[model samples]
Structure formats: C-alpha cells, structure tokens
Target: MADRLQGKVAVVTGAGNGIGEGCARLFAAEGAHVIGIDRAGADECCDLLDEGATGALFQRIGDRHGRIDILVNAAAFAVFDWTETLSYADWKATLSGELDIVFLATRAAWPWLKASGSASIINFASANARHALEGSPALAHCAGKGGVMAMTRQLAMEGAPHNIRANSIAPGFIKTQATARHLAADPAFAAQVLRKNMLQRLGEPDDIGWCAVWLASDEARYVTGADIPVDAGATAW
Candidate 1:
C-alpha cells in the first residue's frame, strides 16, 4: 500500500486539479517523483493540445528523468451539447481535447516509456463511453471517451511487445470543479446521480485516483488492455 510506486517517474497531465491532482498527489506520496503537467495549476504548465509544445515538453521531461515509468493522460475539455444541436466545430474540438491530447502525449512519451522497459500508461475514459447519463448533454464527450477506450486497447497491444502496459479508467460522476457547475445549474442532478449510483453518493477524485495508483504500480503488471470502472457501481445496473 505504501510506496507502491517507489522511485518511479510519473507524468500526470491535467494535474492542475480534479482527479489528475488526486492521482499526482497520491503517486508522490507513494514515493514516485511525479511531474504534474497542465496549462495551469501544475508543476509543469503547458497546453497539451499544442503539438509542438507538448512534444518539446515531454522531450525535456524524458531527458531530465532518463525514463518515464508512468504516463497519466487526464487533461480534457468538452463542450457538452445535445446531438441535435451539436456543431461540427465543437465535435472536432472535443475530439481534439479528449482523444487527440491522449495520443499526442502518449506519442511524445513513447520513447521514454520504452526505455523504462516496464512503463504504464493510464488513460481517463468515462461512464459515458459505455452508457448515457439521462440529464447529461455529452454527445461529444461520449464519442471522445469511446475513442479513448478503443485506443487504449490498441496501445496495450502495441506496448505489449515493449513490456509497456496500457489501460484505462472509466470514472463516474465524481465531484470535481468541472462537475460543480452542472451540480449548481441543476439542483436535482446530484439526487438523480445518487439514485442511479449503487453507492448512493457522489464520488470524489480520490475514488478514481486510487485505481490509477494500482495501475501505475507493479501490482497490476498483469492488467494491461483492461478498462477499469471506478463509478461507484453507477454503471453496474
């Protein structure tokens, strides 16, 4: 439990806040030297959507660290809209934010990960990737996360040859700053979420962060190409 990831070098995107921050803090506590990346509110601020900047940033990190034992792609942005009213531009932007960012970061970190000979890549999917939340207008989010799910399997397959493990975590309605706005707009949303959740409560960032910790550690050496749901059983039904 303690020091599960001792001496590992971890790069966590979107570590400025929310689940990414939770994971970064936990990884460090477990003795990993964590590099938190975000446009703001992280150890290394960079707009991951910028291809050149992202690549350069990863190169710097890889050079400084020698190897990257774990890569957590948790940064994302989405403009939620009903499918009927969704625009092409918004869709593309969502894919770019959610799906493309993952690819860019992974692509940039590939060399360093391979150098480690036993690296782990943890991606963030969502319950939306599997099922729709009744009140949530997240068409683009669903598509993006679905892409992440498929891409994770592909990454696992490709990474297998290099002893690198790839997997994803599909989280439910965790209470984060991002979700706070929705909660404010619809006073009944929280109650509805609880009704659907078997655990009968909103999840915290730590709920998903713990799962990321295990996946990043050697304890999950055999768990590649899997999508673990940290949804408080909301999707179980």
Candidate 2:
C-alpha cells in the first residue's frame, strides 16, 4: 500500500484543512510529490477562481514536476440556506465556487495531465448531492455537488481518449470545522446525521482521503466516470 504513487505529482485544492489536507498528507505518505493549493496559507497560494492564475499555477507545477499525474478538486464554497432564503447573489457565488473552480482548474491542468501519459482526477462531491438531509438547509449545496458530478462525467468522457480518468467521491457527515458549526448550532443536526449513517459514528477526514488515495492509484484504472459514496451508508436508506 505504501508508495502507491511514487514519483507522481498531485495537485490538491483546499489543502489548508479538512479533507483536502487529509488527501495531501496521505498522498505524500504514499510517496507522491504533492502541491497543496488554497486561496491563502498552503504550499502555494493562488486564487483558482481566476482562470489566468489557475493556468499559471499549473504551468509552474508542470514545469517543476515535468508532468502532473493526479488532481483532487477538493475546494468548494458551500453555505447553508434554504431555497427561499438563498439569495440570487449567494446562489451564483455558490455555483461559481463549487463548479467553476473545478472547471477552471481541470482545464488548466489538461496539458500536464495528458503529459503524465495517464492521469487521474478526483472531484469531491457530497452525500447531500443525491440525498436531502432533514433540517439541513443546503439547497445550494445540493445543486453545487450535483453540478460537480455532471461535470465530472463530461470530463471523464473527454479524458478517456487521452488515458485520463475522472471520478468523484460523495462524502458523509465528517467532523470538520464546517460540520462543527452545524453541531454547535443545532444538537438535533448531529442526531439526525448519526441516525442516517448506519455506522453510528461520524467519519474522519482520513476516511475520504483514503478513498481518494485508491482512486488516484493505478488500482482503479478502470474506474472512470464513477461516483463513489464515502458516506457511512447514510444514503442507502
């Protein structure tokens, strides 16, 4: 299991904390040279929202690494708001954060990924994308994650001929700063989440990171256009 990605170069967004940080650590542990990207405070600081900056960032990575082997689009801007209360500006911003970043980053990395001779792209979706959680105001969250899946599918199709694979991971209620807010704000939220998850316990950041490791590894060479749910069976029911 060790050195599963030896000598490979991986670009991980949102690597400052949470699941992205987990992936960056795990991937490096498995022997890949990882470039952690966040808006600020990471191995590199580049606003991926800016197409020009994104392209330049990847170009620099490509030049340094010689090729890019993996990409994890784990950065997303999500907010909790009911559909009625979700403002037009917020909705647009949500979509831009969740979907546009993925599009821009992947597009910018295309040449280097192709240069890898074979590449893997892991996009972070969410359990909320396909299932509605009771008492959780995530109307825009659902739309954003859903759009991520759709975009991933198209990326897989486009990348197939180039021996590039694209897939997504929909994670369950993992204990992170974001989820901590929900737990602190509403006790019932934790109860409902745990009740839905068959595991009867919350997931850790490493849970998604480990899944991401496998997806990035050569073992999953055939797993393109797939959406793997890292939920604790929360969506099964």
Candidate 3:
C-alpha cells in the first residue's frame, strides 16, 4: 500500500482543506509528487474560477513536470437554499464552483495528462447527486454534482484513447470544516445523518481520500467512466 503511486505527479485542488487536503496528503505519502492548489494555504494559490489563470497555472505545471499523472478536481463552493429562495446568481455560482471548476482544471491539464500516457483524473461528485438529503436545500449542489458525474463519463470516453482514465467519488455526510460548521449550528443534523447512514457515524476526509488514492493508482487502471460512492451506505436507502 505504501508508495502505490511512486513517482507520479499529482495536482489536487482545494488542497488547503477538506477532502482535497486529505487526498493531497495521502498522495504525497504514497510517493507521488503532489501539487496542492487552492485560493490560499496550498502549494499553489490561484483562483480556479479565472479561466485564464487556471490555464496558465496548469501550463506551468505541465511544462515543469513534463507530464501530469493525476488530476484531482476537489475544489468547489455551493450555496444551499430552497429552490424558491435560490437566486439566479447563487445558482450560477454553484454551477461554476461545482461544475465549471472541474471543466477548467481538466481542460487545462488535458495535454499533460495525454502526455502521461496513463493519467488518472479523480472528480468529486456527491451522494446528493443521486439522492435527496431530506431537509437540506441541496438543489444547486445536486445539480452541480450530477453534472460532474456525467462529465466524468464523457471525459473517460475522450481520455480512453490517450490512456487517461477518468472517475468520480461520491461522498455523503463527510465531516469537513464546512460540514462541521453546519453540524455545530444544528446539532440535530448529525443524528439525522447517522440515522440514515449504515455506519451510524459521520465520515472524515480520509474516508474519501483513500478512495481517491485507489482511483489515482495503477491498481485502478481498468476502472474508468465510473462513480464510486463512499457514503457509508447513506445513499443505499
């Protein structure tokens, strides 16, 4: 299990925190040269929403590294509001964050990924992409993640010829800084989530991180155009 990704070059977005950070750490531990990208507090700080900046940054990375063996699009922001109360601006922002960011990052890394001849792209979908979260206003998040899942399949098809594999990880009720805040604000939410979860506990960043490691590793070479749910069976119901 150690050094499963030896000598690989990995770029992980949103690496300053949450699932991204977890994956970055694990990738590095597995002997990949990990580049952590985020708005701040990462190896590379840049606004992923800025198309030009994102392209330029990835170009630099590709040129310097010669190839990108792994690309993890784990950064995104979404607003949770009832559909009736959700503004167009917020809806658009959610799509941009959750859906658009993935596109920009992948597009920027495409050439280098092709160069690798066996690159893997790991995207973050969500349990919300498949099922409702009951009380939470996840309309925008759901749509955005659904787009990611679909886009991943298309990317897999496009990347197949280049030996690049594309896959997604769908998580549920993972405890990150954002979810921690929500759990703090609404203590009952934890109980509600656990009640629906087969594991009866909240997930940690590593819960999703390990799965990404597998997807990024050569062990998953045959796996592509797929979505692996790490939702502790929450989505099973």
Q: What is the C-alpha lDDT profile of model 1 across 1-237, one tens digit per residue?
A: 579999999999999999999999999999999999999989999989999999999999999999999999999999999989999999999999999999999999999999999999999999999999998899999999999999999999999999999999999999999999999999999998888889978999999999999999999999999999999898899
Output the better candidate (2/3) by TM-score. 3
lDDT of 2 by residue, 67-150 (tens): 899999998897679888889999999999999999999999999999998899999889989989988888888999999999
Can you tell me which runs of candidate 3 are displaced by over 4 Å?
A: none
lDDT value, residue 133 of candidate 3:
81
**Per-model CA lDDT versus the true structure:** 0.95, 0.92, 0.95
Off by over 4 Å in 1: none
Model 2: how far residue 22 lies from native, Å: 0.3
Tens digit per residue, CA lDDT, model 3, 1-237:
689999999999999999999999999999999999999989999999999999999999999999999999999999999999999999999999999899999999999999999999999999999999878889999999999999999999999999999999999989999888888988889998988899877899999999999999989999999999999898887
Tally clashes: model 3. 0
TM-score of each: 0.99, 0.98, 0.99
